[model samples]
Target: MSTTSLGASAPSRAGADGTGAATGPLRARRRWSGARLAPYLFVLPALALFAAFRLYPIGWSFVLSLYHTDGMAQTWAGLDNYQRLVDDPLFWKALGNTALILVVQVPVMLALALGLSVALNSALLRWKPVFRLGFFLPVVTGLVTYGLLMGALLNQDSGAVNWLLQLVGLPEVHWLGEPFWARISIVLALTWHYTGYNAVIYLARLQGIPAEHYEAAAVDGAGPWRRFWHVTLPGLRPALVLTVVLSTIGTLQLFDEPFIMTGGGPDNATTTIGVYLYQTGFRYFDFGYASAIGYALVLIIAVFGIVQVKFAKEED
Candidate 1:
């Protein structure tokens, strides 16, 4: 009877140990799965949509670039379209025009934005919210509306811009009819339209900076310019990088203003890569060529983006 009881107790003890071990693993697995999988559950929908829309289109366009057709039915032409792009002077010209805007307009616009942002950050400024709203309102305006408004303002004979020039004793000039003037006009219009936007971004960054820094600078007898260079500018580095990168990309892919106002014209002087792509794909019905241009834009933007990332990281 003693031996029988001991054997039964031994079996019960073994079974309890095994059950505890099993439960421990189950609990650990539940905790591990929850921690690892929770973030992905939140991100999955957005990731799915981005892949479905953006990534898929880019991949599809590249594949389409290898063929010749209106996308109705493509016949494989290999790399012929890309090869043709090498010798296409129009492509180079469009590229040069886009580069000019990137080189010139982006700096001018961002500088103005930074200045305006600094001014708005001043406590001396009255009605700060009103001023900010006034600046940002143009950015939210409909693109088509701005385009039409610009066209009216730049109209050669009676446009507000030319009329103002005439009133100032300057000869009435062809704002959009001439190549150099057309480029300048477009740049000015884009700058006017986007400056407020960049200012708003900079202002947000400026607000986040601790007020103690400025107070300390003042106590040290540092003037505004010195304070800006030492404190404000360092604080603005991130905002500057953001503005430069976004503005560079925006100018590189410039389309609407030129398309609506100059129609890429006065002899294709204002044609940008984006506008050129539109003309080739939609206007001339060359989907393959258009896809090639689109891919080229991706390459250009990638290079600039890489440079910006490097600069930002170096700053950090």
Candidate 2:
């Protein structure tokens, strides 16, 4: 009887809920499974929130683009909204303005950023951390505050910039009040705002480039320009492509700087597709058209991205 008692197994475990169920190995496995799933359980709420907020809204916007809505009471309109975009004069104007900025501003900004990155990455540079910090500090500045400051500085009258020009005997140009100068103002603001950000990206890429390549280039009697053209440019190809595509998208959707700087004014001279879309939806309460505009911008960005990737691949 003692031997049999010794051989008898322990009683079933009560779960954490205190209801005795499976015993021994099975109970251990159930607990193990729950432990394995515990992390996912903890993460489930955040995933749910993301789906509810970001994913659901994105899906709904696409659906909403198919209907006409005055902020409410959406009615099925099929492709009519898209068709309307084709004929909208203001849409064309906004698109043209965006394209102009993309063409002019992207190259200039990227070129400046690339040069800055190279300078920063140079071993001969002194106080590298201080320079880097100063360049990057602008990125952390609040958008509205920066915009207001720039607007005040670039003001046609009684502004520091104009005052300096007058002091130097240069005629004061209407930076925000004229179409041509307004666009220039916008480009300057964008370049100032994002050059450091792009430079940081390029700097990371630059750091990853092997020193052996530069040494080899120098050993082959390559001068600074030749080395930069061959080794540096080639090493920076991926970064260049990334920044180009991103800058293109950003310029196409240009809004914040122009909005705060010019109010898309001097007669909508600085109005971008983003600003136009906002005006259409919020100001006019044409929700469907605005949704259509948003999707059109998305489509344009996708096309540009694909083209850029294809070009990069070809270069590869």
Candidate 3:
């Protein structure tokens, strides 16, 4: 009787909902099972599509890379295509040019974006809606249209930019004919296209920062510069990191600007990985080699993304 009494008084094991399991473990198990399965069930379709489209194609491409195919049974030529890429000077040059753009264009564009975002966020900026629309307009403009308009604008004879330079008594810049000038043109286009988008990103983030921090800084006698450096910058770090990583990837994969505007060069100065991939696969019919380049680019982007995330985490 004492044992029975003690057992009855013993603390009960609780189920997930904090109810006594002895009341209904079976029901609890059913509930837990459903909970466990729910997420997988919800994600099943996306997983299926990823497997079918992304995973399968990647696997097939790896297999294809090991062979020489004429759209039929491929003769195995292990590593030959990869070896060919090593000796391909044009490929290296294209990569170098891309690196150059990534180094130069990304920083300039992001800096402009950051400044523009700060300005737009300022209460001092009148006609906020109009200014926002103006900045964002270029971002949504069709790539083809931008390319055509820019091409026309950079035309040596009647281009608006050259005409303006001439009007200012400055030399008419040979915008497209020279390789350096062509590279600069692509950079200009990239900056024009993306700065607004980055600014918009930054603007959204800026709006989320608690106004109290700025108020506190002001209370502490922090000047506008000090408050901005302390409050605004820290708040904007995440957005800036995002902008950098995305811009890096975009610059690395850049194709349309160079392809449409410069046709990859006055002398291949504007060619990038994307254009290289196009030339390898479509123009040269070397899909396997192109796939290899694509995979390499994926790895590069992954590494950079990892580094950026790590740095951001550290900063946080």
Q: Which candidate leads the pack in TM-score?
A: 2
Whole-model Cα lDDT of every candidate shown, in order: 0.92, 0.91, 0.88
Score every model by TM-score: 0.85, 0.89, 0.83
Which lDDT tens digits does candidate 1 get at residues 1-316? 9999999999999999999999999999999999999999999999999999999999999987898976487899899888978989999999999999888899899999999999999989999999999999989988889988988998998898888998899988798999999999889889989999999999999999999999999999999899999999999889889988999888888999999999999899999999999999998788988999898898999999999989799878
Q: Which residue pairs show backbone clashes in model 1?
A: none
Write one digit per residue (lDDT tens) for candidate 2, span 200-292: 999999999999999999999999999999999999999999899888878888888988999888888899999999988889998888989
Against the true structure, candidate 2 reaches a TM-score of: 0.89
Model 1 weakest lDDT span, ten residues long:
64-73
Worst 10 residues of 2 by lDDT: 9-18
Evaluate model 3: give its TM-score: 0.83
Give, for candidate 3, the lowest lDDT window spanning 10 residues.
Answer: 11-20
Candidate 2 ranges with C-alpha deviation above 4 Å? 1-25, 28-32
Q: Which structure is stronger by TM-score: 2 or 3?
A: 2
